[model samples]
Target chain A: MNAFRAVAVAMLLLGMQGGGVPAVAAPANAVDKPVRIDIRNFAFAPATLTVPAGTRVVWTNRDDEPHLITSAGKQFDASRALDTGDTYAVTFAKPGTYAYYCSIHPMMVGTIIVQ
Target chain B: MRDANDSTNERRRHFLGCMAWAGAGTLWLMKGGVLQAQPLGGADAASAADASFSFVQISDSHIGFHKEPNPDVAATLRASLNMINAQSTRPDFLLHTGDLTHLSRPEEFDTLGQLMSEARSGKVFYVPGEHDVIGDNGAEFFRRFGERQQAGGWYSFDHRGVHLVGLINVLNLQAGGLGSLGAEQLAWLKNDLAGRSADTPLVVFAHMPLWPLYPPWGWGTDDSAEAMSYLRRFGSVSVLNGHIHQIQQKVEGNITFYTARSTAYPQPAPGQAPAPGPLKEVPPGSLHRYLGIRDVRHVQGRQALAVTEEVLS
Candidate 1:
């Protein structure tokens, strides 16, 4: 898997250089299986996510501060305030885009797309 | 060997004694309806004695927090209460701006309550920090420390002739936004201040800073500008806030905005760190210098209140 990823990234870089594309790098996190979202340093890692419709997405709080998972559009039931090392999981069955944020620290936001 | 150990112990005690009295607390003199600031210690007794009443402000106790910079937050909070109890000028009340607990746990609130009960002040006012309202939207906080049965956890009252307002801005917060005082609370504030005279001195306390000190980190409030509009008519307005975990002051016209330091831990200065949270890099034994409390003095006839900030060290 590592070798495949390295080759794929190299080929993509070469393609970008040859095609004179913008200096954008490939997506760092592309998960096809169950995914874990880390809440750290007052942020959600992989802030923008894309996953399969049946994938179950899990969010774990890593910072000492607590975070409450709230959907901006009410797409999902809100999670209880997650303390350090606590987690909340939700399965994305519908293929759509959803937005969510930490209700406690509203400044922290994330987005997920299920396809 | 014994003599060497004794000398070291004596030096350590001397160092701690010096730390306790190291920082200077401010003495706010209310004269002719305006407040002026001076050093607190050794101020003329005649002036301080003439003050009508005094109150204390302690914030961000974060009782459940057990981490670097300070492990035992309860101990520090107890120390803070001790200082207030030992005040030469007994404070009439105590205001805990917010962040009374680290994660809003039941035991955390219980510990805070037990510790604050020892304060010599007559009353302790409270507002909810983001940390205090977790999980239940402040149901536990309201049940424990709320002053009124109001829905928004915001209320006001008269203390020593000064109009004090405790506003809750940590609820219904939106994504990618700063702290918010929703429309309901804003309307309440309008009606609350409607009958007050412009000459009445106003002291507003909230969990987040009312002024936009640093918006990127959510240190300020979103609709605080609107709140300031209602307060503009007042002759003297003092807004106290916690959550930044450090002391910062900004004065605009008649309104003065003050953010108090946390009794639990300190955070980096605005833009000083990559993010805003507990600062974990403090050197040993210096954490107390960044943690402390504020004392405010009010004279009966004056329209302003004097504020004093003292570090725990």
Candidate 2:
């Protein structure tokens, strides 16, 4: 009887551990942060921004003319003209400061500070 | 000595030629002026006013447009400016009703700034069009022209006994392409006009049509009626807007709504095209004739605006 009770307690512990596994694992994969950048009138919204590493930043064009989101040193080029309501996103896997501007309108400059 | 008579004969011939040319010129002048008279409406009234305080209304000067309808917008603007400068009564100032630049690029803005500075009228008042605030993060326009303006480029001032109100409706343009006036600005406008009596002549200038010019093109403001409600108490109200690139006028009660032509290109009339864009190429020189400026004059407590569309042929 003693041995059987001990086995039953072990089974209860396994069930609790199984339930906690999902809870712990769920948090690791559940959080997603997306940053939005707006393009209008030849300028960028939040001309300056800060985001955590691995955050996805989306750019949407709201102006009539075509625009581009290209990194300052030509590291990444979203060369296509993003139409109105169209979005372009880039995930910052590595932490760094990225300065960008619309290639079509160079005067439209913005900075994304990633930490 | 024998050729003296020949020289006299030559001089006589020259005299006769001049006489003939003068006769032809007189006939040509009669025909030309007669043709112009047919379309010259309100000429008698205009001529009666010996002293007129007239100002120029330039709307939708969408610079940076490289389309066929208005292949050379800057040139057309220059032509319009020249025409305005050459008018018999030089306008006191210029009122630009928005969409100053096509995409609001700094270069485009810079270019527009340079061109406007060159205008004969040193004073130019502006409001924002939906296009002007794209990606500006809400302050690009103010940084350039908001030194004296209130609330993101909306302001009021008195000019020649006329109360001019410039409103900002293009910020955060709605999804349906409607212009919105935030609660703060609307309240400010209401308070701004609260003290004024009914006799005060008010002129409201915005980028989008304050009335329903056309909804499909997103030409009209969404909350324009609310804005108009504030103006109903005024005896004389004139609301002018751009963004449609055509001339349309409506009179509701004591209020008059006028949409000015774009100095850049012509868009199709409402319901005339599938979508709003640069119209097809009209023959060269047709655009300037179609697009120009409006001249507004206030006389004897009456406000009359004469639109002179000059095609740059």
Candidate 3:
């Protein structure tokens, strides 16, 4: 755990430099563990999720068809079209309820609550 | 073949086309914007030998798809083209209603284009399915297949006295809604049909059904009622769509609606299954029975057009 903290600090310092760095990368911490949401049968598994702010959420497409992620209220950037086995990730840095749906199949909807 | 016998042949063809799915091969004849189903291989089939003009409609090719009930979509699409090529009278043009690719991949579209070009059929026209516009808002799709870029892939043309309109209703979709035509396309459609003679026959082709067939399954369009209002002026309006991946028909007053079967795998009927996706539980060697093409014949001075369906098998 101490080594993990050290690496996290190092990444923070590098990210602080700003140029050519992924500054928004999730910090290394237990609370920040990435969450996963699966897309299958044209619906999102765990249609609702609640997590702490700054938690990274990963969406993986497992259905035979393609899906596109779009924020219902334009809360965050929309994802590109995800084909079978393709995955997309978004990090929530603020506390708010985010509702989204598959633009390709708009009837498929899900909600994410970041507290 | 002359105009003298056209009305007599039209009446006979309508009788044969109204047998109501009498056999496995169902034939549809659309008259005055209404459709009647009949059985194929009937003795009266030769009555339509001299249709004024004929075209073929194929939908949901889904070229990149590799799934059960059909693991080889390319083979099925090739089979579809083969069927079209073998028609006794070659089609004057082909209308692909949409979902031409499984995942909107470049190679998927490439495969479809190559195979379609090789067919002896006439010029091919296309409308964007939801799948075709997945990424970059259909930039790739329009670049390759769009005839009118400024019009946003929707265009109208006159063919042998019939006005055919290809519409794009799969873009700018709203969340938690069904297929949409947006305000822009709706305005364009209203103007596209303005001041035209009501006597002109109209054929409107889109990716999804214009009427609200089933809202739960996203099988209908939201603003389609507005679009339909524009079509009500015409005496004969035949609306053709292909997204449900199966054949379905409905008629509203002056408009007749028909959905074509996909060249790819089959999809469950509305609310038949838990949700709408691929149907993988078909018995062995029965997939071809669910895939087919639609043949439409327009006879001049006749209010309705004749539609014949041919399965891949």
Write down the RMSD of all candidates, one decimal each.
9.4, 20.0, 12.7
Alpha carbon lDDT at B150, candidate 3: 51
lDDT of 3 at B17: 40
Computed on alpha carbons, the lDDT of every model, listed in order, comes to 0.76, 0.62, 0.74
True contacts kept of each: 0.80, 0.00, 0.82
Segments of candidate 1 deviating more than 4 angstroms:
A1-32, B1-47, B289-313
Highest lDDT against the true fold, candidate: 1
Ranking by DockQ: 1, 3, 2
Report residue B51 deviation for candidate 1 (angstroms).
2.0
List, residue by residue over B1-313, the lDDT tens digit for candidate 3.
Answer: 3473674464345433422211112233434433343222221345335346556777788888887657888887777777666656566788889998877889988998998897786698899899898777888889889987456778889877778899988888887899999888889889989979988889899998898988898999999999999998787788889898766777665677888767776676676555677666555676565433223333322335434343322
- Once model 3 is optimally superposed onto the true structure by TM-score, how far is the C-alpha of residue B148 displaced, in angstroms? 1.4
- Kindly report which residue pairs in candidate 2 clash with one another: A40-B134, A40-B135, A41-B134, B285-B313, B288-B310, B288-B311, B288-B312, B289-B310, B289-B311
What is the Å distance of residue B134 in model 2 from its true position?
A: 1.5
| Whole-model lDDT, model 3 | 0.74
Q: DockQ of every model listed? A: 0.54, 0.02, 0.51
For model 3, what is the error of residue B204's alpha carbon versus the real structure, in angstroms, after optimal superposition? 0.2
Please give, as one word, the docking class of candidate 1.
Answer: medium
Interface RMSD of 2: 10.4
Residue A63 CA error for candidate 1 (Å)? Answer: 2.4
Q: Please tell me which model should have the higher lDDT, number 2 or number 3.
A: 3
